[model samples]
Target chain A: MEEILSKLYYMTAFSSFTYQVAIMWFIAFLLLYLGIKKEYEPLLLVPIAFGVLLANFPGGEMGVVAAENIALEGGRYKNLFEIAHDHGIMNFLYYGLIKTGFLPPVIFMGVGALTDFGPMLRNLKLAMFGAAAQIGIFAVLLAAVLLGFTLKEAASLGIIGGADGPTAIYTTIKLAPHLLGPIAIAAYSYMALVPVIIPLVANLLMTKKEFEINMRQMDKEFPAKHTIKNIKAVKIIFPIVLGSVTAIFVPSSVPLLGMLLFGNLVKEIGVNTLRLSSAASGGIMNAATIFLGLTVGATMTSEVFLSPKTLGIIVGGFIAFAISIAGGIVAVKIYNLFAKKKINPLVGATGLSAVPMASRVANEMALKYDSTNHILQYCMASNISGVIGSAVAAGVLISFLS
Target chain B: MELFNEAVSIMIVGMLTVFFILFLIVGIGNLIIKLSNKYLPEEVVPVKATISSEPSNNTYAAIKAAIDIATKGKAQVTNITKL
Candidate 1:
């Protein structure tokens, strides 16, 4: 009887069963439900949910737990090998992929491969809406400062407004890795909720006339396809020029913008390197996303994630997202006041970097208001521009804050 | 107060910089479009030579059939000289 009791006591699982662990297990289940049942960004959420589950098992230590023994003498971070030896594979992945700031730039390269700059090029003026939408970042930054968070923390929290999960993750990793869990979760969750969030904001502000653009009626208004070869040449040169110009002014943006432009160049260059483009956009992207999601989720161990600051970040992020949508819509309305050939204001809501998702939401809303709107082409202009806008915002934050 | 001031500066500088960059992209992209259109103009397709459309078809078909029968379908009309 004594031997059996001792064995049970020695078992880490039996000894470590606490209410906090139970709550973490519940949180993991919640994430799984959101991913599997609701189908919200399941590609990311499912892997993240599994990582969360893997982390809470009492003695597993498969998560990126801090090295209690390794003391920071004077704010010096632990090197990769030191981190790996102390904390294991999850920590190694966290340090190598997340801390080294490698995954986000590579992910941007894949995004650039997937993107088409045609719509943005055709509707050049409309791309300004994408830049205007970034007001949410600064608005939230100010709000965070008023709430007593440090400038670095504010920057991380504010990037959630850009509506790009990877950019938010990249900024957080650079500014405040401690808040990575909450910030990443908020950014991705808001991105998935774009269909809901954008419409709610847009519906309140926009009128029926704003959603009324018929592609059939505008057949003659649109330009002919006489410049096809010219368009292709411009597409090839756009990334290289944009990357060089951005790096010249904002030197810190070079790493992220450089990779993004490189990816776009590979895709646009020609058919000779089609296989390379395919690998970057498809295989490598999916792999990086899985690793990034899992490691980010694994970092959300109970003690760090279940705090007042996490709650604050979640709330602040939502506010930022709502404001971004509003900012885009307002920008289009403002532009319409000055222009003779007015564009559908519904296209403005796509200014967030949720990509084609936000644009799709805008299109759906336009259809609801007027079935013949067909504003998708124009919306793509703003949507693609939003991707660049968010990257630029991330660059600015990093340049100024870091 | 200091944090608030920094946040203000970041907001102003960041928004201005983004707008400037995107504006440059717009300007450069448009310029490229205009230059390409000017320099690499599309070739004008030459008009097809007309040969009294209806009469040519009927006469050519008859001549083709005659040659086919004359050679027991071994020889066919390969070319016709204006002379």
Candidate 2:
């Protein structure tokens, strides 16, 4: 009886694996708690946490769960979390979605469709605001280089400052795939926390006097004819012209810019609105978001995420974002010098990669400063400017380095 | 002392070089955006409800003839024919 009991103990399976699985579950629960309770970027994070829960289980699957090396008879597994050595469903998910660089462009097309170019057109000054927001990219690059990260690694690390999650992922996947896990997580986490993160940084910028101004009226709806004609030119030529420059100069950036532009072009010409809108709002975006969150979570598998280097990346990303804000503020002040009318400094805060959130927060902050002041439109101008500025910066970096 | 001077000179030159480079990049970006907006912008706009044509030789005289004597200069009137 004693010998038989010993054999039974020896045969017990997955004890070690079980412990790892439990830790992963706790982390997933933590993500869920923060997403729900904190109300921090809930729309994206809720789905992301659910994806993580599905991913962290033994042989974590994409949407389905099963025991054994089993499928429906001859079908293959698609789960993202399998034993480390075994290429579980997770492996196939990473291979088909991430390794191929497929999700971002499709998402970009949606961004194009949903994006309104009217604000950017009405407030051309916003372009300067966009340019100012990119200060963090170079500042972080310099810091990374000084810290002894190799040049390629430094550049990859520096891109976190852009604050745009897709842009960061696109750049890093091309430049340093090995660092993708930490980089992507850090980028997305900050993006998801934009509402919390930006307001604190923005509050310091304007005095009590500045915060009281109301800029809601400045959110002028552009004249319909101007929008109908002007928007197409910007939407159509923007990707093509920028893509060519980025590709020809920084060939390394071609994959990212090319696909991003193609997606935008689909929306600009307004052909196949169904397919384009679906890419943005339907299966592709949802599936990609789920995959992006899960695969990134898979990377957090204790062995990889628990490191001094990962911590460094996170800290560096925050600094980069703050620096971007300072840059935009400074740009606004400089523009004020040459132009007759002045813009609120709060608008400068929107230059960070958080896009419209920075603009909204800035505009709201202005309303706090004064009831009569209208600066949202002006802030939006800068917000759009930052987008172009970062893309241009990416093109510049790739051109010089590649 | 000699080494210190060389270090100072190198530091100054390095700082200047970085400053100039940053200025050039940002300056060029600003210039491109400004020039594009200036050179490529929306066309001129014309106001509605203001007539260019005149029934009389002088627009002022035509206005005087069209308006009521009591309301002259307060609410100028245009000729019905012009409408």
Candidate 3:
């Protein structure tokens, strides 16, 4: 009877349960609630929250193991086969995909295929605001370094300001792998809150007159001197030329930006690369996202996530977000001071890589101030450029720090 | 202090590089638009010509009946013109 009771106890997880694990479960459940009930980036959050749940289960051995924990008696790391045999599946996926820094660029390929550069091409001048918004990244990097984080760790933390997940993950994996969980969480969570954040920051910086600046009316008054005649041909050539220029300037960013441009090229080519484009944006992208989210979530085991640093990242990330929006708005205000054709400051606020959501939010805010103000296309000009800007900024950080 | 200086240098360099690269793209993009416009302008497809003859009474009556049913007798068909 004593032997049987001991066996039963060993079978159950109750003996291995700890308060840290309980706390992790609460966090996981909170993420799940936000994903399901609140519909906050459910595609990513659902997979990630479920992964967190799997990792924190007592005696599961499913969470990603740290490199030190997995070190052999001889001070050598275990090979892939050995890791799979010992640490279950999540660690294997982590080492195979996420740690190798393979999936983020693959995801960027999908993003490129789905993106349209026509709006940006038409309104080329607005793209500068995208570059302006990247100030948040450097500003936060300086702040994080002042707060005692090493330059590498500060780079990873500050990249959450870029508002691009793949860029953030790619930089973090290279510079500070340990902080990947928190940085990625911060990046995606804030991206999901773009609708709320854009309005909040825009309200703070932009006045009622600025909000009511109608882009279409300005266009009518001051029409563009040069107009695109062969837009389709220009679209086909833009990605190739931009790719070459980016590769020349920032070779390090090619992994993410190059793949994005290639995806866009394949998408633009039409008929010939249709199958390839579809596979990239559809199957390959979905698989990479799943693995990326799961492995990222699995990295957030109790010992890693329950730290004062995570708190710092959360707060610093919000400041970065608010500052980036403000930076774009301020840039527009400065330009408005001199330019004859004034731009809507709301267009500047959409200068983050959240893409259409940021543009839509900015447009909605404009409509509230003036019913006829539709600036979605104008906002997209900067929004698309923001993707490139953030990627370039990430490359600059990697080149300098790593 | 060294770290702060490094951060500041990176900021200046990074922002400058980003602006330079994007500015180059804008310049090249405008050039492409101009060249394409002058050289490979959009090909205008010719529209098919339509006959100017009037519709027969049977066709006109059919059109009137269709509109009557579609509008639930609310709208009247004032005139029918052919191109």
lDDT tens per residue, model 3, A1-402: 999999999899988889999999999999999999999888888788888888999888878888786687877788888889989888999988988889999999999999999999999999999998888898999999999888898888888888999999999999998898889889989999998999889888888999889999999999998999878899899899989988988999999999999999999998999999999999999999999988899889998999999998998888888888898999999999999999999888888788889999999999999999999999999999999999999999999988
TM-score (2 decimals) of chain A in model 2: 0.79
Model 1, DockQ value?
0.38
Show the lowest summed lDDT stretch of 10 residues, model 1 chain A: A219-228
- Among these predictions, the greatest lDDT belongs to 3
Q: What is the i-RMS of every prediction?
A: 1.9, 8.0, 0.8
- TM-score for every candidate vs. truth? 0.88, 0.69, 0.92
**lDDT: worst 10-residue window of model 2 chain A:** A221-230
Off by over 4 Å in 3: A69-77, B49-83
Q: Report lDDT per candidate.
A: 0.84, 0.60, 0.90
Q: Comparing candidate 1 with candidate 2, which one achieves the higher lDDT?
A: 1
lDDT of candidate 3 over B1-83, digit per residue (tens): 99999999998998898788778878888888998999989979898778557787898899999999999999888888765
Model 1 C-alpha lDDT per residue in residues B23-76, reported as the tens digit of each score: 887787777777767876555679988764344767789989999899899998
The TM-score leader among the candidates is: 3
Global local distance difference test of model 2:
0.60
Score chain B of candidate 2 by TM-score.
Answer: 0.41
- Give the winner by DockQ: 1 or 3: 3
* lDDT digits (tens) for residues A174-282 of candidate 1: 8888899889889988998998999899879887777675534654576544444567778887888888888888777777778888888899987977998998999
> Which regions in candidate 2 have their CA more than 4 angstroms from the true location?
A1-14, A17-23, A47-86, A208-251, A271-275, A395-402, B1-83
